[model samples]
Target: MTISMNCKRFAILLIAVATLGCGNQNDIGPTGRVNGVLTNKGVILSPHTQVVFLHSQGGTAAYGGTDEKGNFAIDSFNDGNIPIGAYRVMIQPPESQLGAEDEPSAEELLENSNGRKAQKKDAEFAFKYRQLSTSGLEFEVKEGENVFQIDLK
Candidate 1:
């Protein structure tokens, strides 16, 4: 009889603890945050790449580059800045490269007149979730902090 009572007491305690623990599981994050690293296949992208967050209502937000560790944070726009809808994220190098690179100097690369920068003016790149393009990727922003890992390939 005593053993049965102890087991019942233990079960009640377990139930109470479990109920308390799960009481706020849905309240993890009120305003969502997006944090992720960008990669293509297995290769991580260069820091010079730009990440653009496009809103459903036709506007864009920009983020520069990730840290040396490849971690990025979009904590500011967590409160549905882009609205609760579809969006296309885009990443582009300073300029599109036509062929293999031989490590040009930073100064030359920075100049808009250098190499293929002028020719790339009409080059199109932006991927949509429904259709397809090279410059963009599609993502649906959910409520709360969302860690979205992007694969550009």
Candidate 2:
């Protein structure tokens, strides 16, 4: 009985030590770093831009933001790396119609008897890039670092 108890305790200790050494395994599998610049007809975009990478498998999407220089890095799964796969890229400008400022406030809508008028502004650039399907932009992320120079016509 004594020998059996000692053996059980040793096994438990070994398992505990092994588990501690291995650390947490919550990470998403097989990711790669992606960095890129956004440009329009050879001109670097300075607006606050958001770049989204929709995975071809139709699940969680990875995204990043651009600085004044239009540089961005894609992050997914709460990490700085994105899962290695093909993605349809979508680029959104700073002042999109879906922006908070573009939408009428609840009070303003309530005050207006005619309801809210749909305000349409002339697009500065081709707005088709805002949609993944219409963007015509595709990128394949590999295991490791990737650099892309995205140019919009």
TM-score of every candidate? 0.47, 0.64
User: Model 2, 31-76: lDDT tens per residue?
Assistant: 7888989888877665667788887874658888878788998877
- Top candidate on TM-score is 2
Report the C-alpha displacement of residue 106, candidate 1, in angstroms. Answer: 23
**Alpha carbon lDDT of residue 151, candidate 1?**
69
Quote the RMSD, in angstroms, for model 2.
Answer: 6.3
**Residue 142 lDDT (model 1):** 73
Clashing pairs in 2: none
In candidate 1, position 63 carries an lDDT of: 49
The CA-based lDDT of model 2 is what?
A: 0.77
lDDT of 1 by residue, 32-107 (tens): 4466887766466555455566655545353445655556665334332334445667665534432334234566
